[model samples]
Target: MQRLDATDNAKALVRQLAETHGDLMFYQAGGCCEGTQPQCFEKGGFFPRTNDVCIGTVEGYEFWVDKDLFEYWKHAHFTLDVTDGFGAGGFSLETPLGKTFQVHYRVFAEEELEKLPPVKRNIP
Candidate 1:
């Protein structure tokens, strides 16, 4: 089982972004003002620090969650989605388009949990 997935709208947006920006990545925000919104950027734009957990990829772009935040959300399955309007921080690439990347979550089933793939982290 996967820790994360994406909605059709989100996948399409990624494709649109890739055509213009080349490559992309996502970092889930966890601090003040940013709340828990997912911030999208051109690949390598925002580097992942040690301890950041890479839940998985959304449309092939890595999706990382702050380690502290991941501890709180580890039990849930995250579904990346897009919506109209600006998210907490305007730093994400989508903000300029009047759209925001968000996550929909649900606790994983017992069987699914056992089969979930391991998450990657910046160990060094």
Candidate 2:
């Protein structure tokens, strides 16, 4: 019932990253360029905005969505996915390895919405 999930490839990549970096996290912003994609970082590496939304976790790693984006996608499900490419102007851990993180989303069904997982509305 989580708002966030990850693809097999994403999970594997994050696993490898966590092994090397200790822990990992993600943030998806909203905008025309860099904000459109997801960014991966070593846990605690990036400072989230105060009002960022913690959508959920992938492989136990927290995944946060920008406050503005979360408002637009509050009823959708998000899945973390990865693709081969350099990341858009970001400091994401995967950027240096010729890969970038992406987010795929879908609307939550009526039934699914009834038991949707909780989200942290702000970083606090």
**Best candidate according to TM-score:** 1
- Model 2's alpha-carbon lDDT is 0.85
Q: Which portions of model 2 miss their true places by more than 4 Å?
A: none
Candidate 2 lDDT, 4-41, residue by residue in tens:
88899999999888888988888888977886788888
Candidate 2: pairs in clash: none
lDDT for position 9 in model 2: 97
Model 1: per-residue Cα lDDT over 14-92, one tens digit each = 8888888888999996899899999999999999888999999977889999999999999999999999997798999
Computed on alpha carbons, the lDDT of every model, listed in order, comes to 0.91, 0.85
Q: How displaced is residue 9 in candidate 1, in Å?
A: 0.4
Q: CA shift at 24, candidate 2, in angstroms?
A: 1.4
The lowest-lDDT stretch of 10 consecutive residues in candidate 1 is: 86-95
